[model samples]
Target: MNNNNNSICNKSVHKKNVQHPLLINFGENQDGDGFDEFILDTFRFVGGRRYHNVSSSKYFLPNDLPEMDRLEKQHYLFLHIWRNNFSAPVREKIITKRKSSLHMAFEYPSAIFIGVDISPIFPSEQKKPDNATFLQNMLDGLPFEDDTFDFVYQRSLASAISEDQWKNDVIYELHRVTKPDGWIELMEPEFLFSKETDAPNCHKFSRALLGFLATLGINGFISSQLENILTSTKLFKNIHCEERSTPIGQWGGRLGEMMCNDYIESAEACKPALSQFIGISHEKFDSMLENIRMEINQNRLYYKTRRFYAQKA
Candidate 1:
């Protein structure tokens, strides 16, 4: 990364204080070096996981439902709750050099207005808009070259990556694809049982969910440690972190209701796995979730989501 170039870009953009428009292109680069073919191969080999684990399902709440529209609405609500319009400044520097095209990649493409995903659970019968393209591919082994994109963004992937993969493969891969002085943002939620605060049943549910995920070699609390994890790489600079509490029920207003719905749907989706690994019966699990919902409505328990971003140097 050129320090002088970055400093110039920063000064120019900060002076304007305008959000930069992102330019995203999903297809192969001008090089045409089998990047598209590699994406196809990855999708074929890395089929989506079968068991709907809670830890993973949080990334895509209501994972079992095939309704694309509802899922998209849920995602938009989530973004609104987190104040997506607050715009990270690092992205402005990346956008200043490009055209006004924006492309986003998602695991489930149906719900999003544009861009593509590895696969769509509910394939849309309607024609896709010109701005949207759907591609099937996995995150761990992206097909793009080093510095292919100006900005890279991923959210709620803690369940998809294990602790080892996070430290070794995932972070490095993200760094490799980002342009020098460009930005990458990761958003994730920490799942921990509330202790000594009067939410015992909710805590028990949280404990069981975390314990079950541990059997699969995933760390449920990884979100809380992301700052340390990314800083250790020493491959990035100007790292920024932000956290917000997501209220679960009506007490938290519209955002709370949406978050509560996400949590409920996430728990419901993981019912089968919870029953199998933790010996939690369907009836018992449903009852417990109801109690948790009540607790959320009463403002007794909440979960926190962390957003981290940095400039690759």
Candidate 2:
């Protein structure tokens, strides 16, 4: 990401203090590609995991390799549940002739891609294909001009962006960039299982998660509520929304097992942040997670996920 023309934009200036030598310090180069430098801080260790160093970001989970693996497993669970590589309906709306896309699903020979993320989670310039370009920028402030894309797709960011940001900043930015009649799709999983769960610890985790999100002014049910949220915005019409339930224990078979791991891993990742939020020690948090893991298997736990695909008015 050190290339002169790289698109990882800088939003917040990071402190130079490193608690561990293994901490990643992606030095900034503002002149490269006219995009600001974006620093991904995973080296700052806390509660035995890593998290973003950006003070303005409200993401509650860790950003280390283990967390990525957990997310990948969750992605696999989605593929298994939907029996497709993606949840959006882009076949006729896109992937036909040559098209310019931001965060597209297909790499059709004629299609060009510009991906945006808060971190350099994608392949570097030397490793990525020529058709794909990436930019590291905060979601609230996109670098593109208005009417810049034929399609825009964002997934799994319900935690990273708050309700206020969605209602006031992020959605408007998306509306501003999307061309009229173009498609915009977003997928967010409730991804939390504190409600309607039979397990005691899972209940505790749920209440804690709700309290944490409330403290940050984020909506806990954005997954199911996003369809109405988008409709209320008045920027888009013809909204297509879908919700799915996934099993979280052995009762759901292999899919359930994977879902179970996704649940526990996510809760565990929040240990560093949420434990403090609820005034608990690291050891007590671990005990709670262990009980949650076993209780889910015995209780037939399940959780809901939702996605919305809409078009600009």
lDDT per residue for candidate 1 within 1-313, as digits (tens), equals 1110211121211111111111132211111123444444332221232322222222332322332334455556656766552234643443322211122322213222222233333233243333343333343254445665556666656765678777877777767756888777777787862331466667777888888778767788899888899999999998889987665679677877877777776676667667566686788888988987776676545667788888898
Give all TM-scores, in the order shown. 0.70, 0.80
- Give RMSD to native, each candidate: 10.3, 8.1
- Tens digit of per-residue lDDT, candidate 2, span 107-147: 45355556655544555455455656666545346554566
TM-score of 2: 0.80
Cα deviation of 119, candidate 2, in Å: 1.9
Which 10-residue window of candidate 2 scores lowest in summed lDDT?
A: 17-26
lDDT of 2 at 80: 70
TM-score of predicted structure 1: 0.70
Q: After best superposition, candidate 2 residue 2: deviation in angstroms?
A: 22
